[model samples]
Target: MRPLLVVGGRELAARLRDGTALLVAVVAPIVLATLFGFALGGDDDPPLTATIGIVDDDGGQFPASVQREALQTEELRDVLTFAQYPDEAAAQAAVDSGAAGAAILFPAGFSDSVGEGNGGSVNVIESDESPLAGVVARSMVDRISSLVEARTYAVRASLEAGVPGDQVQEFVEANGAAGPSLTLADDPVSGGQVDLAMYYGSGMAAMFAFFVVGASARSLLVERRLGTLSRIRAAPIPGWTPVVGKMMVGFGLALVSMCATWLSSVLIFGITWGDPLGVFTLILGHAFAATMIIMLLASRAQTDSQADGYTLAVAFVFAFLGGSIVPVYNLPDFLQSLSLITPNGWISAGLTELAAGAGIGTVVVPALVLFGIGSVAGVLAALRLRKGLLS
Candidate 1:
């Protein structure tokens, strides 16, 4: 056991001593994260801002009071940046060119229809790609519709009660308090905690696990090629000692990498990963499972190149099917169901549970599953190596 530990330590030290390993392990991930942050839109969403182009064919005679009310409302003010266009073609052009998020047109007699209590509708066309713009346009349209409805109701009351126009406005104003307020629900569980970020982060870690495990497994092949394995075999140590040593080293390195990624996301990216103990457990479990899986693949592969190819193919396939590339929810039902067989899927789910405030106790099942997988893979690898098939 002690000899194996010494051998494992020697192996780890040799790998770490290389300047290139540090570049690959630490610097590369940081650079990639920074690039991803830039390309995927800023880490923080730029404040909601939209350019709305308005074309009024109503000859400067549209209801100023209603238009002002629509533009200045609390909801629209925060979301829309309004600009007047001279004609429908110009407004449409602006929206099509992405200069404006949306275009609104008030047809001729817009005010006259509202004045007669007929409740006129304006046309709103928006660029389909801008979700924020669609939300703003829809909100503004709904508010305008409500205002027109309120005015029509006021006219009805005035005619019924024989009240003056001035008193009718007061009548509607006095008794218009029936609908729900426009407060948006701010619950993160239901709304704010974006799921894509979760998928990408988990996928990145899972993909990188191949490197750690592959490198450790490659160390064994290198030892055999160099006659070091024969020396170890002739030593007083048991046959499994070197295998245990490699597993320990690989597990430790995997854990460190997991911690680095989790801490980076929390501190630099402002992500809130909940329950430290739960996250730690998941990280450790995933590290062991990933390392064992790679070692098993290494044992089955015929050469270094074969091992590398096999590990890459397996890891990436798991990543893709387990909701690392596209969201699990967006996948077809069969694919989503099939994700259960993937270790990456379990790791992703366990991490999500930790992020959602689950404690170590809550993550016990997934952690156990990870440990079970690791145990099975490790046993299989050890048996294969003992049979001299891997050499």
Candidate 2:
């Protein structure tokens, strides 16, 4: 036990002392996380910025009140940039050329219909190029329609109560929509926060874990070439000592890599991980498990190049199957179910749950499964090391 610990300690210290390993295990993940978080718009409320073109063909029939109501939506204020156009042709031209995202054309009788409490339709033309812009245009149209309907209701109420026409119109104009025009119903309690963190963080961790295999395989090659394995085998230490040492060091590197990635996400990009303590344990445990598979690959490869090929193949294959690049939610059912065979898949799932505010207790099952994998690999590596079969 002491020999294994001593060997593991030396390997950890050597990784720390090596500038390249330190960069890969720590600095690289941090940089990648920071870059991706900002560029991809990490879970913080996305800034609303869309270009819109408005063409009022109704000869000023579209009420100023409708426009005001449309502008009042927080989504419009944050996510959309509105531009008024005189006609559909010009708006179409702007949209075709990519200058505008969507166009609104108010029909000839639009204002009179609203003024007279009659329902009518307007043309909302959106550029197929920008789905979000189309959504924004539709949303603005809904807000305008709802506000007008609400005002119509208020006016009808006043008339029912024998209020004067002028007073009723004034009341509807003044107080119809004093608050938010859009209420985001069905908004999850936590909003977009968890989804964003889980996807990026888990993907980053899995990708970097692949990188650790390279370092571990290199260290294994060095041991073989320098006769370190021969010397360790000749000593009165357990055959498993070297394998355990390598596994421990690789696991620690994986943990450090993931931690650095998450830290950069939280601090630099202002990403909010749901629960820090639970997330930390989930990441650390998964890293340990991932290193087990990496150690097995290291044992199988006779040369650094062989290890490199196997590591790349395994990492990419598993990462893809496991939802590193795409969420499991988007995957086909069979593929999603099949992904469980890979460590990356389970790790990704566990992290997703953690980001959704699940505690360590919720993550325990996956953790145990991952540990079971590590134990199995460790036993295999120990057997191979004892027989001098590790190449």
Candidate 3:
């Protein structure tokens, strides 16, 4: 038992001294996760309302009519929050200065043009920061403009076809909100939105945590190359001491690295991870699963290069399958079920739920799944080690 402890300590010290473990565990995750957060639409802030600046220079009722009708539209009501402006320049300034997320400018002749049976256009000025919301607002303007155009067309046809004045008046009244009736509302599904910061932060942390293999496998394969493995095998040190030591080294580093990564995300980025105790438990299970899987892979490899190849291949496949690259909720049902078998998926899902403001208790199932995977793999790896397969 003392010999096993000595072996574990030596493995740990050697890994820390070389610096590879630190780089892979700490620096790589932070950098890559920032890239992911940026790619997924920088800043994890979900939009509240389509705060828009309106420049209605139409000098007629159309602009007011559009706003009036927009208020009655339930879908638009969910998103539209307005600030009116007298001109395009002021409206654009509001958009640029962040006073408004988007801006709409109706030209002076807009109503007149529509009234004359000519379609009119409005300029939608939006910041690049809120591209999705800007586009949605622009579509809203297009819809309102179409409704106005349809009303105008009906009036024009009535006059041209020699319809009586009373009948033409009736025509205008009946077609006011006509043309196309549509609704656009975001699905209010709870936890439907994935916060980019948490998504990538948790993903990169779990994905790189598996690099514990690079160090652990080195301890095993290096001993074999130097014939230390056979010497230890024949000595009173016991056949399994060296293997246990190396596995301990990998498991300890992985758990520590994952915990550190998760903590750093909260402290440095001001990211919120709910329920500290629950998060710790889940992270521990994820690390355990990662270590066991890596151990098994290391057991099958003959040389350092083969071990490295196996690590990279397994890591990438696990990352892809486990929701490291995409949210599992966004995946098809079959894929989501398959991902449950991977540690990456479990950790990712747990983090995503926490990010949505659920307490840590919500993640118990995933953590338990991870623990089960680790236990099964750990058993299989132990059997292989007993058969002297790591050589």
Candidate 4:
């Protein structure tokens, strides 16, 4: 145990002295995360705003109701503005000239048609440059149309139920005044909103952790090439002692890289990771997994160059497949399932949950899975090292 610790300490000291190792492990992730965060827009940016044109040819209650209730609602006032156009041609011109993102044209006699139980046509004109604005306009018109339809149905039902003909207009007006029974309310699951900065920061950290540990593990090949391993073998140390020591160095470097990235992300970028315990647990698990996998890959290589190649290949594969490059939520369903196979995926998910205000308990499953994967890879790496390096 003493020999193993001495060997591990020596390797760790050597790694700390390597300028390239420090840059790749400690500096690169935070720098890239800052760039990504700024590219995605900051929290200080203004809210979205769009203009919608209104063309009411019918001059009826339905169009008036839409203008009063849907377009001018307090909730939408900050994001949407309305302009009244004299005719459909003027509204279309407004949309084409970019004065308005979209337009709603209520055709002549539209209310009469709706009142007569004949569905009326409502035309929506959308700007080519602002498609989302058009979508919002269309949704608003659709909601008004639904309300009109509901009132028409209620009027027809009252007439059929033996109500006097003179009272039917009263029923229509009353039903139209009453809004839809079911209204949607927002219920956020977590207190903290996970911004783009935190997401890419965590992902960059997870992806680079592989390279950090890989460099440490590949040092075995470096020592072998320099004939240092031969001299070390002549000592009274056991064959497995050097391998265990390298593994320790790899694990230690992995933790350092992850923690450094985390600190930089918070202090420099002002990104909140949420739930300190959860973040640490995820970091520990991912570091263990990264070290084990890099060790396994390094064990299969014959030379330092070959080990570097293997490390680069595996690091990129895991990074791409894992949500480190593209978010898992945006990926296709099949690819999302494939992410579960990588340690990067597990850590990214756990960190994401934490960012979204989840408790420490939420990360337990991910941490356990990471540990399980590391254990399996560690066993395989030990066996391979014993057969190849120890021999």
TM accuracy, model 2: 0.60
lDDT of 3 at 5: 95
Residue 363 lDDT in candidate 4: 98
Instruction: Judge candidate 3 at residue 264 and give its lDDT.
Output: 66
The reply for model 2, stretches above 4 Å from the true place, is: 43-198, 359-361, 389-391
Q: TM-score: which candidate is best?
A: 4
Candidate 4 versus truth, CA RMSD in Å, comes to: 7.0
Indicate the worst ten consecutive residues by lDDT in candidate 1: 183-192
The digit string of per-residue lDDT tens for model 4 on 35-58 reads 877875246545656788989889
Model 3: runs farther than 4 Å from truth?
38-194, 329-334
> What's each prediction's TM-score?
0.61, 0.60, 0.63, 0.67
Clashes found in each candidate (C-alpha, N, C closer than 3 A): 0, 4, 0, 0
| TM-score of candidate 4 against the unseen true structure | 0.67
RMSD of each: 9.0, 9.1, 9.6, 7.0
How far does residue 318 in candidate 2 sit from its true spot (Å)? 2.0
Q: Please write out the lDDT profile of model 1 over residues 1-391, one tens digit for every residue.
A: 5797797898788779875345544555545544554454235655556777788777544435445665666745665677889888998888888889887788887766765567688888878545456555665566566666766766676668887765665565576612223322221221224433443555566656656666777777777778787888787877777766776777677677666766666666676556788777777777888888888887887676787788778877887776655545445669978776777777777776666555667678888988888889888877887776333
lDDT against the true structure, per candidate, is 0.67, 0.69, 0.74, 0.79
Q: Cα lDDT of model 3 overall?
A: 0.74
Q: After superposition, how far is residue 297 of candidate 3 from its true place, in Å?
A: 0.9
Best candidate, lDDT-wise?
4
Local error of candidate 3 at residue 158 (angstroms):
44
Q: Give the per-residue lDDT digits (tens) of candidate 2, residues 288-315.
A: 6677677677777777778778888887
